[model samples]
Target: MLRLVTTSLCLYCQRAQVTPLLLTRPHSVIFQEENQLAVNALYDLSVDISKVRKLKGWVLRQSAVYVSETAALLRDMGASGPVIARVLELHPEAILCNPDQMEAQKKLWMSVCASQKDLVGIIEKFPASFFTSSSDHDNQKANIAFFQTLHLNKRIISKLMASAPHSFSRPVKQNEEMIQTLQKTYLDLGGKEDNMKIWLQKLLTQNPYVLLKLPNALHDNLAFLRNVGFTSDELLRLLSKLKGFVTELNPESMRLTLSYSEETLGCTDAELRQIVLQCPALLYYSVPILADRFKGLLAAGVSMEQIMETPTVLELTTQIVQYRIQKLRSFGYDVRSGSLEVLNGTKKDFEMSYGKLRLRQERPLFNPVAPLRTED
Candidate 1:
């Protein structure tokens, strides 16, 4: 009788333990089943499943097979299997988008795009741009209409939508305010009214995200530049030269870069202005990068005067400078004694210069037009 009692107690304990486990099992099984569905769907679509798993595992936990919906949409848009797979791989969040929302986005994009082919190309290149939240659809449409009223070319608007979707995703009022600020700044700096449209288009093309910045950023930077002694005309010229990137700069960063360049180049404020005018990179490049480039040049026997004369050399990396110097040395041309202009330019330019030097060396010193004989 005691044995029977002990057996009953053991059976009750086992049931108690299993009851809790059974309760939890259904939830986990459902999650695993959903994940498996996503995995299978992606595998069928020929996507890089490993990347999806690694970069966006959370996408698999949803109950729906979003990958299939997204893939079908891409296929209907004339995207090939490889392109569809690539788009999904690059932006797995695309799978999480609602099918109806994606369809609406397709029609909205088609309005801007010349054809399905162009739309497909844009989607292939910028998946995230196309797969933005459905909630922003209204704002995007309003912004597109607003840009149209501004007389921006449809192609430029399309480029903006693809490259800077966040700008279009915002309320039209925000973009309008930013545009007004830009226009006011331009006119205040003596920009011609006749050239305003072209200027705005060029600026937007150069940096569409510029509109995303607050109007205060443009105001603050201009104020700082004026305080630093740049006249209105100089500021206008600088604005034109920067291609609308001036708004991206803040006073503190600019102050540090200016101070560093002024001290490193041993130039007065006026001279530094000229240098910045010649190479706006002096403003764009960070101080550490400038310092490294300067150190590389000075160590290579290049004088500060040479660097000032060709400020573009600062664009070249230290490794490139060293390689070019080595190539010039091989040609018996010493950069230390020659102009830094020879070191500047693209790789093709350097190769052409090197070829000329090689030809000059191969030519006989006394003979002006004699061909050199080659041994058989």
Candidate 2:
């Protein structure tokens, strides 16, 4: 039995007129289990309930019982109120009270009410109307109460979110090591200054998805830095030199960057050509259609800038075919896949060797499969 050592009067035991157990002797009651390990199970907790001391006052005792029962029920329902409250009690300072937290709460509530009509009905019909008039302070309080009511077993969620405010406000430090590694590798490989920029751009474009995994504030800062030309070719060359010494790495990991230059600065044919001049490795093996488009555009007196912005000649031709296919499909006609290929092959031969596509009516051959026999 647990002993109470107190100078002040124990009100609970006073009401029951029962003596608070003193651990002077080694007398053991049924409450003191010989098999202490058995208490690990809930069934053990239930088995020993009879030996537990009852609280004074029927109303208070009944309320305590009901609360305990409800808490257990909520636990089984996967709702966690008591645990949330305990977590908050443990780290009251971490509780969100900022304007951003308030905004988040408002957004959460809005989304919940909008998507869940049943939740709306429950909120409206709940006996106390708990959610009806939630002021900012009340909202925060209610949020705490709601979490506490969920009966969460562990304080994992609370602990995880506890450091969020600090994390959100702080900027992540740039990895100088990665920058150095990139520089060393490229410079050691004899990559020219101009080539590094092209390499970086290519890396950024092909791996735009990297931005999503990055911490947002840091990513925004990096984007800003890039805009101001912080990621210059000179810096990249220096970093490339640093990369030569670093081993046991893919070397391309740090290359995963956002490709803002593609859409913003515009990766025109001229720019691509510049990259190719600096780094021949960057060139595609086959871009015949692209080359032809540029050639045609140039021949037609179209400026390189204009041609770059407009769809390529091959792309435009493909678009035309696609438009025709879509129109035909809309009119209850299905296109066979190989039909376009045959037409394209014919058109290619005609346009290059003979002439452009022209209307040519062809004589039909005698049908091998005759029309179905019609009888009156």
Candidate 3:
């Protein structure tokens, strides 16, 4: 009777809290047979023993079948002990799931991204997406169907899944409605009504997280921008190229920025529109950053038209601008006073051009003439 009561108390402690009484007092453990079996099983699980003891109830309950078959199945599927342990820790309900069902879930995710490391990475980032249930598979299928409707290539879809695993778990109806509405709005507002397929492709290229924003939220955001003096065309053009701005900027912050740009920063309304249309992302920049870039442009002898045309120059980070400008200065090329095209080129293009010039400048001057060899 005393052993029965102690066993019930220890089991209750394991279920209710962090540590079982037996785990706290190892020598006092009356269930040595079960404890040894569990401890040995979990030690090979590659998780800290101390931590595993906290989940002794679950560890032991699943240990028998898991040690004999379940774990072997995971190992056979090429999942390392650490990855399996982490999956269990994050989703302990997985222990109760059938081993065959768990194996199927692992295979499903692997099919999305063939790389085992990437599968492990997504699992680490988001274990909920890889649930072993029929509903999970249904949601994943719907998400894949939605992406397919957009006509995105398989590689891009794989990257999207790897980067945002939840993309595969979101409600299909919600994402489908949001994307369809957004596409219609883009065509109507951006003047790309004639070529929607291309516009959506461009939007996806610039912002793969397109489904992150719902249609109503986007409509509300566009309404705010329209009130802030953006014409339909300007809004469309800006959103097409600056896909992240909608997710980043809100109406309240946007109004303050518009007021600051026109009232304080001395940018005319037309100039503000041009700036945003040329670089919609500029709307998301802080007033101080916008001001600094404006001042930097003036200081560098950059023309207003040049700044308007190649607004991405304003998108460069402070460090990048300083480093590249200084590097160009060292090469006797005055980028500030020179054509703005150089500033707008990508880092790789700039590197290829400037790196060669720098190498030439650093090269030691060699004379082709050899000293005449006289008979000596």
How does model 3 score by TM-score?
Answer: 0.64
Q: Specify the highest-lDDT model's number.
A: 1
Show where candidate 1 strays beyond 4 Å.
1-34, 345-376
Which is the winner by lDDT between candidate 1 and candidate 2?
A: 1
Model-by-model lDDT, in order?
A: 0.82, 0.32, 0.63
In model 3, residue pairs whose N, Cα or C atoms come closer than 3 Å (at least 3 residues apart or on different chains), thus clashing, are none
**Clash totals in order:** 0, 24, 0
User: What order do you get sorting by lDDT, best first?
Assistant: 1, 3, 2
Better of 2 and 3 by lDDT: 3
lDDT of 2 by residue, 215-301 (tens): 333333334433434344433442232222112222222222113223322575355433323322221222444445445534434
- Tens digit of lDDT per residue, candidate 3, span 1-376? 0011112111211333433234335556543233455445556676565654466445443322233344555566577877777765555434334445556667666656757666666666655555444445667777877777777765566566655556566778876786788777876785655577667666665676766776766787889988878888777777766764485567777777677666643578877777677666667877888788777666766667666667778888656777777778876878655666566567898788787767877898877796766997
Best-to-worst TM-score order: 1, 3, 2
Which stretch of 10 consecutive residues in model 3 shows the poorest summed lDDT?
1-10
Q: Model 3, residue 207: what's the lDDT?
A: 72
CA error at residue 235 for candidate 3, angstroms: 3.0
